[model samples]
Target: MTVQTSFESRSPATGEFLARHRVDSSVAVDAAVRRARVAADWWAGLGFTDRRRRLLRWKHVLVRELDGIAELMHQETGKPVDDARLELVLAVDHLDWAAKHAGQVLGLRRVPSGLLGFNLAASVRYLPFGVVGVIGPWNYPVFTPMGSIGYALAAGNAVVFKPSEFATGVGVRLVETFAEAVHEQPALQAVTGFGDTGAALCRSAVDKIGFTGSTATGKRVMAACAQSLTPVLIEAGGKDAAIVAADADLGAAAEAIAFGAMGNAGQTCVGIERAYVVDAVFDRFIERVAAIADRIRVGAEPQAQLGPITMPAQVSVIRRHIEDAIARGGRAVVGGPESVRPPFVHPVVLVDVPEDSEAITEETFGPVLVVNRVRTLDEAVDRANSSRYGLGSAVFAGRRTATALAHRLHAGMTSVNGVQSFATVPSLPFGGTRESGFGRIHGADGLREFARPQAIARQRFRSPANLLSFARTARDMRVPMLLTRSLHKRG
Candidate 1:
């Protein structure tokens, strides 16, 4: 008998074994996709009203079991309970939004067919792509993956989720709970394992793929999907930065920047890895940031402000970035070399780092921040936009200045006075540009992302000219030229 392969999930906080999950082979992934195909047809046939009802029930189930799911998230991802709860709450809110707004966002609507089609009635609608494959990340597993899953399901497609290996237990719980709301239909299912399983999901028969991971891995996922001509949505890494103007609120900027950098142990893709403050206020901002960093307690305890790194190997990476900054003449304003202790990395605040240093250019997926001073707000914007990442950014300034500066940012989402506030509003689309990856998840655009636009036209009347029949009409050809000349002749 062939033995089945399995992997174990251990708490990064204490290295305690949490749960075991079977490694799904490519054959298993194919089977799941097939099941999803059947479920997609049934779900889509139910129409928007019935599907919305089912999804709302699923949302209710999630809300009722939020505590249990949050606990599993804490154990599997090594995040504090409150952090887990916060993430879960956001995920559930997205679920509710997606379910309630999907129909209106994607339903068929009358559209202008232009002057050439005056005799025809035209409409357009978003149609499901059948089955969608999702490759989730370990950090914020609940919130991140649901950004794709909830929207995809609301758009009338079945989902085959492949959660990160470290968060397999949490993935399983989510699938089970969703199953209760959608009994007997394989509308939502999870395939567990390591990278191989995720690779399998990419190559499965799903109609589209929603991937969240490093940029390097995202390229591989895209390549795999290319084999079958399947469409894909990639949500990758970011070296997000925050800009603090001379006229900005230094205290609020410090508090927001510190939380943006240290929250979730800095595993977020849109977290503030770098901060550029105006020279006039840089000193005060640094002082406030350091004080806030000092107050953060890194542990698995309830009172701790931040938790351990979910990935053990990331510890060395964090250490390397910090050391590289210091070796290159950067000064540690708060924690430094001693900050990285195994799975937990105490927040490290560095300043005077070179703009070209790895600390500024790279995505340090750890609780570390590098603050740099610029002579003016223009200089701050230039330095902030210099990185290859264009994910999420924050600008702290007066309303007009902040708005003006925000427009100049290269990132996909920019907050005027807060950090990551755009992510909380379900109406705004979230994603990035450049190496951070393409495509979006959230709101109306998110629902449309999982679907394809289909146009419909009905002949309400026949044109006297019979222009489309090609019945050798000289006027048919001359009429368009005359109309074009009259309508678009340098008006």
Candidate 2:
């Protein structure tokens, strides 16, 4: 007889295992994809108006059960209830927005046939890609994954979600709510397991995959996806930086950095991992941040300002970051390497860390920040852009700070005077350009990612230059070049 052991999931607030079930070793994720494939036709046939109505009702269910949903997330991840509420609220808004905007964004729109091709009428419409597979992270599980799931569903593609093992309960509850709204249809299905389950989802016959996790895991996921030639959107981890100018509001900057860095025990991918302040105001900014961070407290209760580290494996990563920082002549004014108090790791503030140090070079993914001083904004931008990870960034500058620094930072999303505020606005596209991964997860970009544009051009009448027929001649291409040169030539 063979006995299989299980991986136990525990609550970060309390050292108690929450669930211990045998892992699902099924390699049949293709069936889940097929179910979704069938569901896609039914879902898309709803046309945008009916889809909007259904999704609206779904959003209502989410709003009605917001408290319960938040509690489940809080209990599973050990994040504050308020924080969970924050994420769910955004997700709710996105569902409503996506449902309403899908028709307009994905609807067929006519394209102009240039003067040379006047005989042809052309148009393009975004068509659903059948099925999309989403592998979500534990931190901000709702908001992050919904960016893809909600949009994919709205665009008429069926979604199969694989939530993080640690947050599977939360995923189940969300899916249960959707089932209540949509009846017993597998429009959205949740598969629970460890990395194997996730890899299966990737290897399974899905049109596209959207993954959010660490960089190393992201590469592995990409490799797996490559096996099936599956297109993927990887919202990998980031080492985001916040720059504080000398003329900025020191108090607000400090508080923003503190909350942005320490929120959710710093298990955030876009969290403020580093802070670069001008030498003229570095000392003042450091003082303000240290004071604010020290005042913040972590507790097991739901009302606590901060909570515990959700993933147990991350505890070691956090410790190593702090220890490495301290060992390399970095000073921790507020908290240090021994800050681990069981499930919760208290906030730590480091200063005077070399830009080339391990703490600055690697992603800590904890409630910690590495502060450095630069002589000029040029130096600040250089240091911020030095890292391989450029997922997100923030700048505290004068009136032109956001506009000017926007061009300097190499990341996809950057917020001025706020930390990660770009993510809240539904108009902007989220997801990074570099190691953060490609493909967008919000706004128009989100809608397009799950769609394939089928370009159709019908000839109203036989063109004088028939490019597709044997009668066509190479001379047909000369008209376009001549027109282009005539319109803009110096002569």
Local accuracy by lDDT, each model: 0.92, 0.86
- lDDT (Cα, 0-100) at 138 in candidate 2: 94
Task: Give one digit per residue, the lDDT tens place, for model 2 in 1-491.
Answer: 86344566677778677776445554456677788888888988888888788888889999999999898888889889988999999999888888889999999999998887799899999988888999999998899999999999889888999898888888877888888888746889887778988998988888899999988999999999898899999999899999999888989999899988998888888999999999999999999999988988789874587898888777888898888888888999999987877688899999888777778988888899889889998889999999898899999878677579868999989989989898898767899977888889989888888888988888899876666777667797677678779986986
Runs of candidate 2 exceeding 4 Å displacement: 1-8, 17-22, 473-485, 488-491
Q: How close is candidate 1 to the true structure, as a TM-score?
A: 0.98
**Model 2 steric clash pairs:** none
Evaluate residue 147 in candidate 2 and report its C-alpha lDDT on the 0 to 100 scale: 95
| Reference-based TM-score of each model | 0.98, 0.96
Give the per-residue lDDT of model 1 (tens digit) for 119-149: 8999999999999999999998899999999
Which candidate leads in lDDT?
1
